[model samples]
Target: MGRIGNIINRKGKQDAKRASVFTKHARAITVAAKEGGADPEYNAALKTTIDKAKADNMPNDNIKRAIDKGAGAGGGEDYFSNTYEGYGPGGVAVIVETLTDNKNRTAGNIRYYFDKNGGNLGTTGCVGFMFDRKGQILIAAENVSEEQLMDDALEAGADDIITEEDGFEVVTAPEDFNAVRDALVEKGYEFVSADIKLIPQTTTVLDNEGQVKAMEKLIDLLEDDDDVQNVYHNWEITE
Candidate 1:
């Protein structure tokens, strides 16, 4: 199959990925609620954080129970979020964000994956400069005009907004995420997902083989680790 054909077929893999991604995000929400306030009304970040979870089909009971558990005694100690910087195959900068209580175990496994997969695990701040943390909001594209979308997003404190073929990517500061999400929600926008994400400052172009193989290896290593919450890389991909 050609590259585009392979990408078309990979839609199934994305569905599989959702299951793993939701599990990781669930842990993140539990941790966030524990550290901050459990009440989503008071904790704006946690509110949007859980919103993304629910957007992905996470059960309402699980969401409510996570908040209760997060506020309960002895909950925060089981999870902590951290970001690891590294260089992947072809010198691609990769950042792995994780929520794990056992930092030692997570670190050891991550380092091993990098070493074994033609990558190098760098020290803190090594490749971190390659990325910037931002608020990312995605809303359904149906019947939404770019001009109206831009106006609404900017009014909601978004730094910039781009309308994609399938949806809109609204960008904002880490602090402004909740406000943007709330504004969009009140406007009756149908959002697929809304959360804080890290965007690569720059991206590296890769061949089709490089893209598939590198992602396959990275995904395999990541899904095996219970501590990994999210992984971000600068490898530029296309259909």
Candidate 2:
């Protein structure tokens, strides 16, 4: 996504980008299966993970192998989730989510990135209160009217609909995520992206090029790490 303003564009090679996406999805599927059991029917989380993977066109064989690894059929390595909170240049708050097998290694690497980029890693929940966790679904705006999308989304239990530059966003409560998503799917709405995110309540604006450059470098470093699952920040860049 190359979104101007609040949304940071993810720019990279198409092939490498796709491979990274698939790897992350596979890891998520494996973890969900390992923790919740291999049967998606009995495991709501696993089912949702699979649905997300399928939406991205993840190969069936790869999905099956990940599930197998989680069930010990393919000898999967153990992994655990970790989160880090910190402040970047211009007092911009950021939260980094990670899935890792080695806590020390990941922590060291994360701290280094923050320190090297004129930032500091803070204790857990340092900036969490500044954001709201919500289920987000993004769909293309093409061939659809705003009124129509809003009506359908609200009726499906979505809390709100935000009209983005190139798409429509449906925000739902965590518990109502699956219900709203499935309902929209039934109505034949295809999504560009669907997942839970920590939306910032207030954003920090960077006026100077130096601050913007530092923020970008911090984000790029964090995202390049394989253990880092997602990075949320409060810096709002203007065009």
Candidate 3:
């Protein structure tokens, strides 16, 4: 499996809890809409969130309601974006992105999770330099030709393309993501997953079983949080 495939498999496990997954997606959408305007055309963040929600198969009604809530058409609690960087067992870099109305509660919970799982939350930018922000779009390899995909993706301003056993990962510069995705869509390509992500520059492997277990638990705990939208890590997990 490729990096995108690995992500898909991990998400597949998380998707088993359908309600929780939808709730997280909804929260992200609302936060994006709240920070930017409700109109996606004028709000790149909102557009990206909406696209991610759609890719996850979130219902249109739920998406609309979340947008309305954030846009103030339906008054709701305000949420703020918070990013927490940390190191897990084996010194693996981890970045948690969240949207929460209560910073104290979220921060406390996040810190507790890390502390309890053999990790420690670090100051901002501590582990940030270890990763690069990029746009990733995943397309299944079932019937698609790798050469054609590379040709189209490169033409659409994509930065690179990775061929995996199960799919194709089209990478793009953050600024060119929206245009590249849109161009692909116009050309009738469908996505398995598409989002701006923090891609790790290097990966850490835990040879000790205890540290591996701790790292896995740490990721699970972070991902299960209602306020946490994303948990990026540099741990090289094997199947």
For this target, which candidate reaches the highest lDDT against the unseen true structure? 3
The worst-scoring run of ten residues by lDDT in candidate 2 lies at 4-13
Candidate 1 on 1-239: residue-level lDDT in tens? 33223333443455567767666767877877887888888887677778778766778877777777788843445776788999888788888988887899899999888888778889899988888999877765668888888998899899998766666788999988888888988997876556687889888866668646866697578765768877788877654
Off by over 4 Å in 1: 1-19, 73-77, 208-211
Q: What is the number of residue pairs that collide in model 2?
A: 0
In candidate 3, which residue pairs clash?
Answer: none
Which of the two candidates, 1 or 2, achieves a greater TM-score against the reference?
2
| Residue range 1-239, candidate 3, lDDT tens digits | 56657776877987787788889888888878878889999999998888888877899999999999988898888888899999998789999999888999999999999999889999999999999999989998877989999999999999999887788989999999999999999988988878889999999989999999899899888888888999999988765
TM-score of each prediction: 0.85, 0.90, 0.94
Task: Please list the residue runs of candidate 2 whose C-alpha ends up more than 4 Å from where it truly belongs after superposition.
Answer: 1-15
Better of 2 and 3 by lDDT: 3
List per-prediction Cα lDDT, in the order shown.
0.77, 0.84, 0.89
Misplaced by over 4 Å in model 3 are: none
* Location of the lowest summed lDDT over 10 successive residues in candidate 3: 1-10
lDDT of 3: 0.89
